[model samples]
Target: MSSSFERYQKRRLISSYFSVVLSVFLVLFLLGLLGLFVINSKKLSDDFKEQIPMSVYFKDQANDSILKAFGEQLQKSAFVKTDTFVSKETAASKHKDIIGEDFMQFLGFNPLQNSYDIHLKADYVEGDSIKKIERKFKENRMISDIVYDKHLVDLVNNNIKKITFYILIITGFLALIAVLLINSSMRLSIYSNRFIIKTMQMVGATKSFIRKPFIMRSIKLGVIGAVLAIVAIIGVLVYIDSQLPNLGVLDDKLMIGSVLLGVLALGVLISWFSTFFATQKFLNLRTDDLY
Candidate 1:
């Protein structure tokens, strides 16, 4: 009977430890996902912004030197992420691809004008800013006309703003949920050892002395669980990088590193507080309460 009782207690302790680890892993995973979205929001915006090109048309008098100078100027401009100067021949080829005929051959001259195709910085790709940019371009003497999709700019900006707002809200809510869950798990684990805590108090052990071991153990468990979860998060990034190379934006090292550090700090702090409180509760309880 003595042996059976000891075995049962050993199994129960092991089960409690596993339970705490699983809980911490799940919470950290959720937080990792939220961090990924928040950190890579810029990459998300740039992906769409690059697809919508802004064209700056040139005058009849514009030559290779003029176009080259303009390209060099744009390269230094904060508004420009990338720019390409398209000559008349290249424009004609693009037209051929679209119209399914060499219109230049039929008309005896290329009607398309030379132009600069520019992609704006992600932050500058908005409706009002794009219009202001067009006006800014028109101030130059060499530029004849500028064209871009006003509606698309509006759509992209609006969608990005909405996504940012929702992600923030969800992150806060989930973080709260994670804390509450870890607290409950810690409470339950401590509750199982309530009699031990009470018996130690009955002896010569002071409150602080008894509290030390439980808190230390909890801290260790928390750290182990957090480290495991961080490994899982890194594994997730590696898997995505290999399987969906198109989503490379998800691999921002600084952001992932920040999230990992945050998880470690949160896990240790939460475990410390939960263990302290749980031990405190049992310490003050009456002897009959142990039953």
Candidate 2:
């Protein structure tokens, strides 16, 4: 009867420890996912910024030769990524599609002017650089005007900055909370085994000797938990990709691997430090406090 009771108690303790470890891992994994989003959002914002259009309207008298020369010059500009020429005919065709065939027919001759659709590099989308580019475009004899939605560009940049700031603040707060929670859970787990620690200390065990096994155990637990969390995260990513095909494009396999490795390293590091501190605290506690 006594042996059976001891076995049951041991099993319960092991179960509790495992549960706490699992909880710590889940919390860390969630934090990792949040970190991933914060990193990738900036990338997505930059990608969109690179695609913003900058339209250069040509003079009515500008012939294809002059327009082509202007395009070549524009291509050589530091800000330009690529420039595409949209002739009057192409412009008319687009307008006809938009306003219907009869509406275009009423305007006997094509009234649309030729233009160059320019895509700038992401870094040059700022107000100062765009203004500089505009000035350069106006210097060209064949170019009449440069048109772009400045308001939309400003709005996008402002929103991205605001979002980045908020995400950084939130990430910092969440990380602090996660660390505290994990530390508390680890302390409790160690506290449950305080008597065993005390017994070893009483038998002439040095502090390092007492700390070694606990550290090793914590590391093992952390590794197991991290692996489980990574598996779960991968499953979640796979499901999301299935539901939203576009999400698959955002899936950087190398980045995902790095995140997984980082999570594992974090788990091991946090667990080791938490266990060491918790064990040290108990080691310094008075015998009377044990009860």
Candidate 3:
């Protein structure tokens, strides 16, 4: 009968410990997932910005060799990602296809000018950087005018900034909630051992002595939970990569490593602080409060 009761008590202790670990793992996992999204959002924004093209039309008198050499020079520029040279003939043909008839034939001559559609690097796609690039390009005598949708540029920049700000706010809020939840879990787990804590104090065990074991145990649980969360995050990334091979965001090893390290540190730090405070509460409690 005595051994059966001991076994039952041991089972109950294990169950409580498992519950605390599970709570930490789930919270950290959710936080890590959001971190992934936040990191990738910047990459997606840059990709969209890089797609905005600047069209450069040359003067009608500009010869083919002069334009070809100029296009090669533009391709070598630091700001240029790619430059697509469109001859008068190609533009007219494409315009004809779009309008469902040969407008050039009706007009008796091709009105289209030779041009290059240049996609700038994301860093140079901003308003000031684009202005600088335009000034530099217009200095070339062969170039007549540089054109791009100024409204679209402004819209993309403004919208991305707003989106990033909101996501940051949401992430910070969720992080605070995660901390509160983990702290509560730790406190409840300690609460179950209130009587044992009191008894240790009554036996003349120093506060530090009593706390050392509990702190170590909690830290061990925290490490286990963090490791479990990291593993789960990796599995999720693998599944996402398999389904969407084009999502190159997972290739950012440094960002992923930073997030994982943060989770591990948070788990350990929160656990230690939560356990220390919870144990301190019971240690200072009067015997009457133990009831």
The model with the greatest lDDT is 3
| Residues 66-94, model 2: lDDT tens digits | 98888788777887888898998898888
lDDT of each: 0.87, 0.83, 0.90
lDDT of 2 at 4: 100
Q: How many backbone clashes does candidate 3 have?
A: 0
lDDT of 2: 0.83
Q: Which pairs clash in the backbone of model 2?
A: none
Question: Where's the lowest-lDDT run of ten residues in candidate 2?
Answer: 244-253
For residues 1-291, could you state the per-residue lDDT of candidate 3 as single tens digits?
Answer: 999999998998898789779988998999889899889888888889999989999999999899988978986799999899999999998998898998867789988899999999988889899999999988999888899988999899999899999998988998888778878888888888999999999999999999999999999999999999999999999899899878885799999999999999988998999899999999999999888
Q: Write the per-residue lDDT of candidate 1 for residues 53-129, one digit (tens) a residue.
A: 99999998988898888888898899898898888889889889998998877789887889988998877888778
- Could you arrange the candidates by lDDT from highest to lowest? 3, 1, 2
lDDT-better candidate, 2 vs 3: 3
- Model 1 scores what on Cα lDDT? 0.87
Clashing residue pairs for model 1? none
Query: Which candidate wins on TM-score?
Result: 2
RMSD of candidate 1 to true structure, Å: 2.0
Task: Judging by TM-score, tell me the better candidate of 2 and 3.
Answer: 2
